[model samples]
Target: MNKKQWQGWGPDEQAEQHYLVQPRALAGGGDVRHVSAFLRASGWRDKSKKDGPLLMESPDRTVRVAYDPCILPGGWTIHGRAGDATVEWSAHLGRQTPVEIVAGLTDALTRPRSAHAPNVWAPLQEQNWHTRFADQNYTATSPDGAAWMQYRQDADGAAMWWTGAKDEQGNGWTAHFTPNTPMHLVQAFSTELAGPDPVMRPRGRVPHSAQIRTWSVSVKPSQLSAWQQARITAARAATWARTSARSTRPRTTARPYNPAGGARTRH
Candidate 1:
């Protein structure tokens, strides 16, 4: 049969295609709870259609958030649209899904109406040190190959040294150390390259009686790269300003709030 004739005669095929394309209904999942909570807190009104996909409308009705639970593997497909921008994504209920729908809807509803007004700032853009560290790739390793470190300077001129090592269980531990001075960074690199070896304790009362073997680490003057020297220089000029301020701040005792719209101070 020709294509048109075959399509006209196939009721089962049409039904199958419709079901495959439609969003499946989700009974219970993390997405439902999170989305529901977000909607209620954000003042979004539910305008879902009967026996249709779940739908939420922003308070001003400028944005719409839709979820179809029929999408498999990923529990649901969330689609959000505001003005000329539209975003759609699918993720399983338990997974760390990019639920940008919440942000988009919130922005659309609360944003300033004026075109000249400044845009709303997003807190996610201000990533912490840990987040920045996770994005870095360590290009250098210690001489013993047990430790790795990365150096990064942020756009705001903040700099940090990230060091990490793996434990016996293959789990990793990391630390951020701010160099007190340029010499401090030099000493850190030197120690990593040629640090002292572990010494055994004397078994007898006379420590001098026991013979201990020792080895020296040799590093040529040319071995220190120019980049390393630059880092050392920067470290020397850098001070732990935050640490100093925190240490010098006076401690205060917090008091309970008074219903009279005033806070009671103990000190």
Candidate 2:
């Protein structure tokens, strides 16, 4: 479809678009942890015509992962299909899955011809994605080599909210860490086609990743620090400006009832 046509399409139309992103790390097996993945998928399907991308990244966006060179998340357990599969996933947020599941999934997936990696992690969007029992802090690294987002839900089915291309600052945002980019998380995203859901769940002691991807890199250290500072300043300013704006804004009051004269009067 043309750019205009793509932009004008509705949610259902967009949903019909199937995007498959099989971004996997081709690391030789031997207990390797650190990994990265860039998932890009997009497609369109007719209503009720079960058409989905082979590698689905939440709805219509991509994500990244950074690992801490530890357990390669050798576990994966998928319950339901994408968008509703969260029974055991929510419970396992931020924590390593049991050793048994991990070993099983990895073995099955890594077999030649059956080589698969359990990337089925919870909502990486964090903001838009919904789930049951939301947690304020949860992060996971997928076997796909990307880390998950810090969502606000936990064990129960939550909600998904998708904010379009515009940022709250009214500035156009093309990447994460933009300060106002809405988190486009999937309540129960698609399943991990490979096998076990090798994701660490919430309450995990391991350090969580800053779910943001680096779109641009600076060769000079000075430039990098400046970039970081700009973002930090923007974030802080956004917070304070929002708070101050709210504090100064006048709230609308309900019109007073006039029972005696039956005439509405403004107080």
Candidate 3:
């Protein structure tokens, strides 16, 4: 970083004051690569302030802005750092692609039964790969349960990948992730949709959940003691269930059939 001196309210100010400007010429020419510039504001207000801009100079030598938004609540925002003190921050807003279904689950609607009104939705099934909206978790579903959506990956698959799991009844669940760009469009109410595909959830965020059978515990016993214990427990439960079932039946006698002495009918 280089520094210079300027006078007055700004560089244009008639008053004489010292100001600083660090400028660079675009390297590799237009055919090769574009150029960039960094500026530090000084003297006009306080002694030390810094600003940066990534620029693509005009072929005709005019100023053109590609994409730049400051630390505010608008598009492409960067926020949450006063001066870097090990603080955590996030950059996301509420934008979604709305879907209404009686039973289907997606990245959007996975929460309490009371969350979705029965008029439009059935209860969330565990088989779906979705979980409820957490406070720190930025996800959404409308009041009537008609509209629902999630802030999916804004970047291409080349940069990042989203992994997820489904509940027993197929409710979808996504682990929390950070935004690539400082702030991204949350895809609220409106969805940028593609053509048809069948697994029922959005093609972009859908993850295939392996069919996990609980009986694996019995199949892959970790220890000799565990296998023996499972067998004993299962045997006891089966015997108890059988006894309980038999006690509920009416008392009856078995007819003697082909006994050593003779075949005898019940009295």
Candidate 4:
């Protein structure tokens, strides 16, 4: 009987890795070859055969990205690290082309850095606040459920006012602070809803809207078992080295050679 093949990274190598990006498909329909090509073009190295996951990494060995070609259309995942911080985010491939999906994910991960406060909320806060918003339209709460922030949109304009306090049972108060609310208050409201350094949430585009869309912010835990983190780090470094070697090598362009050694004069 044939043996079942191992589908994941080696047991000894899984520790050092932290996923930077994880792309998923709604029902599993994406071409892995395209994913590989995209990574190579973007300066990542391909370390495995064409049939395996298109694993690659940055030239500096700080970031790694990959997707399993044999996993059907389930999705793709990219892992990256900077300093002591590690980040992972994923999205469903949906109906978009693989190039588009990968580009979007790459752009989100590689874009310029901005100065922002670190997220103080825990993962539970990040998940619970959004869930609550779906049920209650004008209510916001901290991760611990100890504080509440509420807002209401104006009936005539794109204006909102928010109040933060102990709970929802306080005396009702309203204010018209449109167009210029305090930054600290805004940050407080944002921190309560989305974690620190929030990326824009992914919502399908609005019809006929020309506004520039924002990248969704989905952060993952940085803490990992030592062995698991090491495995990922090693994989990324190895993949990067392989691709860098190929990219830096000189290419010889093939020219049609004449059978005769002598050059023929144009007739």
lDDT of 4 by residue, 1-267 (tens): 223233223342222222221212111123344445544544565676655555677656755655553455534454444435453322222222223334434433432343564332333255565324432335655454433444555556464444322222331112122324333323432342333322221223211112212343433223333433554455456557767887999979886677877877686
Residue-level lDDT of model 3, residues 162-196, one tens digit each, is: 22223344433322224332121112102211111
List candidate 1 segments past 4 Å from native. Answer: 1-31, 38-43, 50-52, 73-267
Residue 262's lDDT within candidate 4 is 80
- Candidate 2 per-residue C-alpha lDDT over 16-89 given as tens digits, one digit per residue, 9 for 90 to 100: 22111112111112221111011111121112214421222222222212212233432222111223342111
Count clashes in each candidate, considering only residues at least 3 apart in sequence or on different chains: 4, 46, 33, 19
Candidate 2: lDDT of 245? Answer: 86
TM-scores for candidates 1 onward, in order? 0.25, 0.23, 0.15, 0.29
**How many backbone clashes are present in model 2?**
46
**In what order do the candidates fall by lDDT, top score first?**
4, 1, 2, 3
Candidate 4 residue runs with Cα over 4 Å from true position: 1-34, 86-98, 114-132, 135-267
Task: Quote the positional error of residue 52 for candidate 1 in Å.
Answer: 5.0
lDDT of each: 0.36, 0.27, 0.25, 0.39
What lDDT, from 0 to 1, does candidate 3 have? 0.25
Worst 10 residues of 2 by lDDT: 33-42
Task: Give me the overall lDDT of model 1.
Answer: 0.36
Q: Write the per-residue lDDT of candidate 1 for residues 1-267, one digit (tens) a residue.
A: 689656633443331110110001111122243354445444557888898777777555645556665554323333333335443222112121212222222233322343443211111122111222343432354333443445666767576554444423433334343432122222223232222333211122111211223223332223323434553343333324434676999879785657896766777
